[model samples]
Every structure is written in structure tokens, then in C-alpha cells.
Target: MTTEKETLNYGPVLFHYDLFPEKIERHGKVKKVITKRGTFALKEAEMSEDERNWFTHVIQRLSEIGFHQVVPLYPTKFGDYTVQLGPKTYYLMPWFASDERNERAKDEVLLDHLGKVHALTLKEQDFSNEVVEHSYQYLMNRWENRQFEMERFTEEAEQKTYMSPFELTYLSHFHQIMRMTEEAKRRLRDWYDTCQREKRYRSVLCHGKVSRNHLIFNPSGEGHLLNFEKAVLDTPVRDLAVYFRRAAHQRDWSIEEGKALLDLYEKHVPLLNEERGLLISYLSYPEPVFNAVDLYCSKRTQYSQIELVHRLESRIRAMKKIRDFCDAIMIAPPPSMDENAPKNIHIHDEEDHI
Candidate 1:
């Protein structure tokens, strides 16, 4: 980190207490501001007026709902959440102390906070049937293309007189990849049918990027979600899918651990029947197979044969774990929603202020 002479001019900001900047430390696009008042984080990003407003509204709403896991943005004297200095925009938030939680503990905190966020943002609405059907068709078409590409790679590899080590490895696992793809398609079809029959879907403002990097844990072992630039209105399972995939991959495809994490999340926000089906379908998608195919067919060879083989093997192992987990959960009946009802379903209509 490099020290910067130009500290954040906080005099113009509507701070609750007096603030005196002691030093400014720069780390890429973020700045750590140490002040007599307290330490805070300053981030610079390009955000439109609407985007800024949306972020401000989300933070304020979360705060209003008593969800302290989200760090609120400090507003400027002009009552704007973001401070604009020419073309660049900046925002300030409190710097939370890092927690000393183990890997599994960290995941638990993340899912717990995520469940709270989903519960607060969840809304019951009737999604357009056409839109849902179109999404399902799009996913199915993409999966079909992936299957075709895998087959093409297998055929081409068979024709090659000298097969590379990576090619051999991929060929060996091709059958398993195809099996997973077929199972994924079947699950997706089931999910689509369920959605169509239900005609109602639950929507929540998902923290689009749910990764360890974006999750900030405090000393008390509570995790706060950071970076809302990519946040969007989607199903809660979107976050769960991203999290579960990474967690399972990191732990080398441990189904027991993955299910335990899901159970932790369920304790906060129950997964509905449709939600469970959607999660299983999303997890069933052969992401690693698609990645392997993309890398093999790329114009430039970026990785060695050994590295490629290792990557593919790791992916196959993780995918198998995910597949087994999905199969087990799909067969097991979804837990009762009443067991995980939201503590406060009523959201106050507070005026937006950040």
C-alpha cells in the first residue's frame, strides 16, 4: 500500500461526529482512510446516477430493516450518497475488523447473512410465464451446444494419431460428463415444469457476487456483504448456487459439508419447493465440462497438458460431488417452510435517505 498526500476531504460530508484525516493509504481502487474519528474505507468506481441511487436505497433499506450486516454509505453535505469529483465517484464506509474464523465458520456466517438478506428482500410476485419459459429454453439450448462441443472434441481426439495427455484424460471422462449433462437437462426440464405449474416465483435482490472476497467478517464472527455494483433482482438460489459451487470445489467435493452449509442457510430462510428444484438444476449444469471444452478449443494454448489434466480432474471430482448432493436432496422432501419463516415480514415504508 502506498501513502497518498491527497486525503479524502470529509469536511463537506455530513458526518455524525467530527473527523480529522490522519493518513490515506491506497490499495488499487480502494483507499484506507485513518482519521481521528475512526478508520473508514473509500472506494472509487464509475457509477451512473441511477446505479448510485439504487445502491443508496439498498443500503438504507437494509439498515432500516435492522440488518447491520451491510455497511451503510455515508452521504455528502449535499445529501448525495456518492461524492463526484469530475468523472470519478467515491463513497465511504466504516472499516470493519477482520474476524479470525475458520474456513467452515466463515462459510456459515456468509450463508447466515445471505439468508437474512434474502428474507428481507424477498417478495411474492407473479412472474411472466413467457419469460420463464424463454429462460428455460435458453439454458437448454446452451446445454445442448455444450454437449455437442464435448462430442466434437471426443471425435477429434480419437482421430488424432498422437493424443496429448490432456486429450487422453478428457476422453476418459467424457462419458461421465455426458451423463452429468443428460441428468442436468432432465433436472432443468423438471424445474421448468414446476415453475410453469406454480405460476408464481419468489424474487429477491441478490448480492450478485457472493464470494469470499466480497464477504467481510467482523471480530464478532458476523459477516457483512460488500460490493453491490453487480447486485440484481434474482432468485435467492442464485447466491446459493455461486456459494455452494465454490465451497464444494474448495473442499474437494464433500457432499456432507455442502449439505451442512445448505442446512445452515435453511435455518434462516427456508427453501421453497420451486427454489429447491431450481437450485438442484443450477448445480447440475456441467460448468466444469464447459470450461474444459472452452480451454481445449481455444486458439491459444495457455496451459500445459499436465495442468489441463489436473484442472479437468479436479472439476470432474467436484461435479460428481455436486451431482450426488443434488440427487440426494431432490429425492429427500423439501423441509417445511413454516420452520424457517421470516422474523419480520413487514417492511416499513421509510423515505430513502443515505
Candidate 2:
């Protein structure tokens, strides 16, 4: 049953769509709004005016290009795709119930859909030295800084006569972690060099946050994608790296499964050589492990030493799996390029609103 307080709180936002919620169930960042009209997913996000506009544009543009698998935004009575109430923004879509039967094959479906999106929007660019150099140097410097910080943390832990369990765990694997970091840097540099030599690069409309959770099956068993708030124009590898990295952290995820998924994606849009290298570079970095250390440093008192150690250990294990995954794909060649691969994708000027 819907609480009176909940209905009152959400009523103003729903007013724009003539939706008076009978029940509002919290589901992560979304609200399951049950109303007389029908069930809907009310997505709450903190987006600026510019972001809201771009997000709508991304959805509209995808549809314009014949991609309609996205969960569509329900416009208000006033024709606005989003309703803003104070600091929060709300968008509406028909809520699809979770289907456990389709859960197992979600990854395959996600990858296949991702590849289709990438293939459709892929744009080859004539590289600008300024862009390439700035990107390369910026990432390298940021990574190097993070590497230095982790090293300093290790030094501090080593100097302590009696280190905490988390610190000791981190220290033991510190050298192996550093090796991965270096390997990541080497691959990144190689990607940059290849780009400079080739004077080329590719960009696609990346989903930014690619996950099984962002997908849901409709009543007819067709998968539809949602939550494209973080979409951006970047290398196709950006989405792949994010998806693969998170997937690797799962206990059931295997290298063969990842490879098969990658193969499925490649069938639609085969990666260029440097793009593959860049993907490897992105995956090889042990950022998740570093994040664990940050959490330990900032909130150590909030969690037990054993808890922190287990957290760090979990990330380290994931990194080891990622290492093996990278090795398996290091020499795997990109599939042959598609003759009908998207070309002539017209990207507007940034001033014109990307």
C-alpha cells in the first residue's frame, strides 16, 4: 500500500504528468509509481539543465537513427520529457517487472545490444595532435599521481611497528599491484603512440554505465535499455572496459565467458587495433583496489579491520582474474572490419550542444 506521506511527497512531480500515485515503492534510484493510469518507473537523477537536454537529445537521436530499443521517456502534459522539482529531476517510463528467467542470458544480450549501438554510431576521426597529446598526458599524469599516493600509503604502513590487518594485506600485494599499474601504463602509451603514428581515432556514443541492471525485459520478452544519463561521445572501448571490469568482479564470471561476450560484440563492430590496446590499458589498471585503500583511509573507523582486509582481498582477487583475462586477449586479433559499418555519422559541434 502507498503511504500518505510518500504520495504527498511525490504528488507535485507527478502532477506534471497527471499521475497521482496510489503506491510509491523505492527501488534503488527509481520509484515504482503505481497509478490509475498504469505502473511506471520514475527515475530520479541530479542533472543540470544542460545534462537533461543532452540526455533527451541522445534518446531522440538514437531513435532518429533507427535504434528504438531504449526505454522511452514519457512526456508531461506540457510536453516536457522531464519534470524538475527543486534540485531533483524526474523522468517517467513504463515499469517492466524483473524476469528471473531472462537473468542468466542478460550479459550476452547486453553485449550484443551494446555492439549494435556502437556499430550504428561509430565515427572515425582524423586525429588532432592537440587532442591526442592532451588526452594521453592527462590520463598518464592522473594515474601516476594515484600510483604515488598508493606508494606513500604503503610506506606509512611499512613504518608502523604493528600494522592493521588491512594495511598488512595491502602491503603484501602492493608489489603485484604496482606491476599491474606499470603494465597498464605501458599499454596506454602504446595506444597513444599507435594513434599518433596512424593519425586516427574512433568515437561512439558510449552508454557510460553499461550493466545488466540497466536492461530489462518487456512483456513480450524483448530487452530494452535504460539509464543513459551518463552517455557520452568517447571511444567504444569506454563502455566495454566498464562492463568487463565490473563483470570480472563477479565470482561466477570466467575468462572464457568474457571472451565469448567480446566475440559477440565484435561481430557487430570489430575493434580497431589501437582501440583493442586501449581497452586492455583501461582494464589492466587496478583502480578498484586503490579505491578500497581510499575507503580504508577515510572510513577505517566505520568498518572493522577484518572487513577492510576482506574488501581489499576481494578486489585483489578480481584484479588477478582481470590480469588473466587481459593476457588471453593480448594477442587475440580483431575480427575483420564490416563493409557496411556505419560511416558518415554527423557529430554536431560542441557549441551546438553534443
Candidate 3:
């Protein structure tokens, strides 16, 4: 629990402490803060100068668009973002109204809200140098390093645990997944290179992380976006891909559902055929991302073995859903039409028609 003085120094809002086990984050601090102004999510993390600029730029831009997705309690001196406190920066945001629960939402409502967000233009948003280059470089570097880590981890796991059938099978799966991920990374790089070659590598300010959990609905059912930490200037299609991947995690989803969501997005920001293909191709990497996360979580000192296993299982499940989605798209054949064909229109008749 943060002391009164600590909370006072952190921001304008003083919060009511909740002693519950902090279910949302088992290993981290979770406090319910209250103040004369409003409540805010007080999180602590070590960030770099580049990351600081990224958040600053994103918050300033989102606020400018009147999106109301994320409200900075303490905005920057230029009224763009918040100030850093000590080595740990704190964000004073609106204490969401009581209505923002974790329950599932109907697909229609969710899709509509997402469409509205994607509709917002980034031209009016605040941005800075190094934002795009830093973010892109970070992702590319992670992809390269992560592949190496996965290969080494799989090898070690195989050498140590192959006595068990489950271990051997898992190692095999891990190796296969790593190779697929490497391919995805290569494709993504190619897409980036193509964009540069065509002089179409312009950055669009984006929410970076898009999901229902980051949304808050007001009394009138108006939805608000949140979680701007990952916001950075990169490919807009990458943002769309992240949303699609997350939406794919929901139940009652079909090809039509995905199409409807994408169609709605197209209304706001049209995507070229090639851009759409790039987004589709990028979907292949989530499984590898989860596998990397699984490896990292196992080494995290904060989590117990049970907690680690639970987190790994959830990520694996999400990855599996993404994999199944990829499979469905891959196995699809070109559309065929012969609804009014005559009875004699068999394989032999098809040759004659051609």
C-alpha cells in the first residue's frame, strides 16, 4: 500500500486502499485511489527516454483528437503528456466510472466501438522524431533476438527433458513454432522494405494496443479507449492486425464477423489490397510471441510456479485460437460459382466449358 504522503507526492488524487488480493495483478501493487479531483491508475515501471517520448507524443495526440480514450491526470509541461516522478513515472488518469466491468460484450456493440476508434485521424495528433524509428527498431530487434532465444530454449529443454513424451513433443512444437515465427518476421521486414521502396513508409499515429479490456463505457454506453503505453508511430496495418488478432480471441466469431469488423474499419481508413495482405501475413507471429512470453514468465522471479503455469496456459490458449484462425484462412480455396449449372455439368463438362 502507498502511504498518504507517497500518494500525495505522486499525483493530485489520493486513493482509498483496497486490501483485497489485487486479483487483476497478482504479483504487483493494486490500489484504489480517491482524491478531490478524481481517481487514476498509478502504475510504476522503468522506462527509457525513447519510451517516454512515445507515451508523451501519444497522449498529446489522443487528447487532441477528442477521443477521450486515455485522460492524462498530469499532462506534460507543454500540455502533451505527464511528468516523470523519480525513476518510476506515474500516470494520473480518470478513475473510470463503476460501469467498466470485465464481462463479455456482444460482437455488434464491440465492433461498432472499434470502428469509431479506427475512424479517428492521426494527422492532428502530436508526434516527434525518433518515434517511428525507435518503435520499428525495437520490434525488429525483438523479433531477431526472440528467435534466437526460442531456438536455444528449445534445444536445452529437449536435452534435459526428452525423457518425458510430453517434454519431447513440446520441444518439437516449440522448434516448429520458432521457424514459423522467423518466416513471419522475414515477411514483415519485406513488407516494411516494400513500403520504403514505394515511399509509402509514412507513420500513422495509432493506439498500438487495441482490445475490449482497454475500453471503458460510460452511462450512455459511449465507449472510451485506454492503455496508450504501447502507442507509437508505425504501420497502421500493424495496428489493425493487433485488433483483428484480439477480436479473434472472442467467442461467437466467424469469417463474417471478422469481415464486418474489417469492413467497418475500411469505412474510416481504407486499406489497399497489399496492405490487407500484409496484415493477414502478420497474424502468423502471435503464437511465437506467446511462446516467448511463456519462456520469460518461467524465469520471472515474482510469479509462483502455479501462477506461471496459469499465465502460460492462457497465452498458449490465445495463441492456439490465432493458429486456428490462420489455418482457416489458409485452407480456404478460391470462391466457385455454378449455382445454375445443368445436370450434365460434371468434370467432363467443365473441360468443354473451358
Candidate 4:
């Protein structure tokens, strides 16, 4: 199926690289370009001009700052890191094949690299009252709106004479879920109060989407991260929260395993008390379970009743795991930073970093 016509479809973008594809295999959004020279991953992404420029800048800046664990992007003959055609943007990198043997080590590598990225660019930003107030109020308003919607859903289900299995499952856990929501809101308030009192906050270069899938192992067995499309300068907790939330959904994931991983990460960059609270708040919100309910309500015909019920149950189980993890977090502080960390921490400005 790898014909000349198929390769030609991407020729306009490949022309800049001067590569003649012998074959191209589509893997998700990336095309595996098999040429006489070598195999490469040609990634197709949607990025505005600003996002494309910023993405290329983040990859390069990570290298310039001595954090080169990221996958190295290949440049074209014209020395451009990315190419554009119509509404799509394309970039190229060496095709690093996946290794199943290293699968178990993924979370460790992901968090470790994330910690390095955060520590290298960590900055204690001068507090801005206007900025802090706006951020806090925006998030609080959003959370309250979602809570009200869930309450309305519960009331509607209760009024029904005979509820569906999905409704029954939701009703059973409704009280526990609400408790978790309140806990998340309380923690968010604590974070906001601490920031206001201390007049301080920290920002770092965060891999906005932190997941095991974004990490790939090279032939040498070292893990190199890819997909920095959503990279940004923000609080370090943003990445940690994102990582832990996703991890909680896995069947083998445990509170002990989660805490051990957090300890490994804190060895590189220890989390402050407020940041820890923020991470807990982010994890406690049962948004995933709420999303399952929304999907059942909006698209029940698309999927079977049993499928929807199973999905809701799966999310509820994950929420329980997250609740326990939050409890363990409150018991102790993050482990100490590694002694080898530099005495002078690098403070990266948003404009300067990306």
C-alpha cells in the first residue's frame, strides 16, 4: 500500500527535507517515512504560526539549557524545524521504536524528566495581585458551575419512577463524590489564601500534557520525550497533577506506587506546601466521572447501556484511588532534593523560555 502516489501526498512537505520516501506507514497522526537514508517519524499536527514557533523554540531551548532528554527534531535543507501546507504543520524526527521491556519504567522516566525540566527553568515570580485574583476567581467560578450542573442531574434522576442502571450506580456514590468535590474546593481555597499571604508564586517550563505515551525509548534504551506541542511556562504542579490524575486510572496503580514516584521526582525538585495542596485539589475533582455521566446523557444511543454503566463504574473506581492518594499526601512532606542540584536555580521568564 506504500505507493508513489501515497508518498506524493506528503511530497510538498517532504520536499523541504529533500527526502524521497520509499514507503510511508501511517501511525496515528505520524507517518513513518522509510527512505534510503533511514526511517523517520513525520509528525502531522495542528498549530497556529505562534504555536509552531513556540514549539520549535521549546525543543531548542531545552537543548540549549543542557536538558537534552527530549527527542531531537530534524531540520530541513532550509534549516527550518517545521513546514506548513494548507492547515497542517509537519516536523520530522528519527523513528525510535517502542520496547516492551522498558514499559514498567515509563512513569519513573516521565516524572524524572519532568522534574529536570521544571527544576532547570524554575522561577520564583514576583506576585501580581491582579493576575492571582483573576486566576483564582476564574477557576472557582468554573468549578461551582460544574457542581451545580451535577446537582441538577441528580435531582432529575431522583424524580424518575424507575432509574436506569447508570443512574443507580451514580446515586450510590453521589454522596462520596460530593465530599471529594468539597475537599478539592477547600484545598483550592487554601492554595489561594497561601499565595495571597506569601505574595509569591513559582513558574516553570511545564510539559502541558504529561503522559507515558509521550515518552519513547531509543535503540540505546534511554527514554526520550516527544510531543512538546502543548509545552508552556506555568506552575510545576500543573504537570504533576496531570500525570497523577491519568496514572490513577490504571488498574495496577497504587497509592504506595504513586507516593514512591513523587519521592523520586522531589529528589530533583521538591514541591512547596501550597503546590502540594494544589496537586491534591486537581486530583480530587471527579471530572472524569462527571464526563462519563455527560456522555451517557448526550450520546446514550451511540453506545450500549452496559457500556455506559461500565465506563461510569471504571471512573468511580479511579476516583476512590485518587481519594486515598490525597489522604497519604497530607501525612508527610516530599523527600529532599538531590545534593547535586545547582546552587543557583535557573529562573526562566515566560517570554524568554518559550
Among these predicted structures, which one has the highest lDDT?
4
Listing every candidate in turn, what is its Cα RMSD in Å to the true structure after a full C-alpha superposition? 4.2, 2.6, 12.0, 1.7
Q: Which runs in model 2 stand beyond 4 Å of their true positions?
A: 336-354
Which tens-of-lDDT digit does each residue in 137-174 have in candidate 1? Answer: 99899889878877888999999999988888888888
Predictions ranked by TM-score, top down? 4, 2, 1, 3
Question: For residues 1-354, could you state the per-residue lDDT of candidate 4 as single tens digits?
Answer: 498788779888889999989899999999999989999999999999999999999999999877888999999999999998989999999999999999999999999898888888888888999988898899889888999999999999999999999999999999999999999899999999999999998889999999999999999999999999999988899999889889999999999999998988887778889999998998998899899989999999999999999999999999999999989987876576667755545555565443
Please give, for residues 1-354, the per-residue lDDT of candidate 3 as tens digits: 545455445443222222122212112442445544444455555567789777766666556654454545455344534445567654545455547343445344444444444445423123333543565577778877876766676667667733333334445456556655765676666666655555443335566777766676654655566666776655567677777676765555566666655555554555543455466567767554455355553665665545555544555555566666655544444233334322221212222211
How well does each candidate superpose onto the true structure, as a TM-score? 0.82, 0.95, 0.63, 0.96
- Candidate 3 residue 79 Cα shift, in angstroms, is 7.4
The predicted structure with the larger TM-score, 2 or 4, is 4
lDDT of 2 by residue, 84-185 (tens): 988999999999999999999899989988987887787777679999999999999999999999999999999999998899899999999999999999
Go through the candidates in order and give the clash count of each: 0, 0, 6, 0
Clashes of 3: 6
Q: CA lDDT, every prediction?
A: 0.74, 0.90, 0.53, 0.90
* Residue 122 accuracy (lDDT) in model 3: 24
User: Lowest-lDDT window of 10 residues in candidate 4?
Assistant: 345-354
**Clashing residue pairs found in predicted model 1:** none
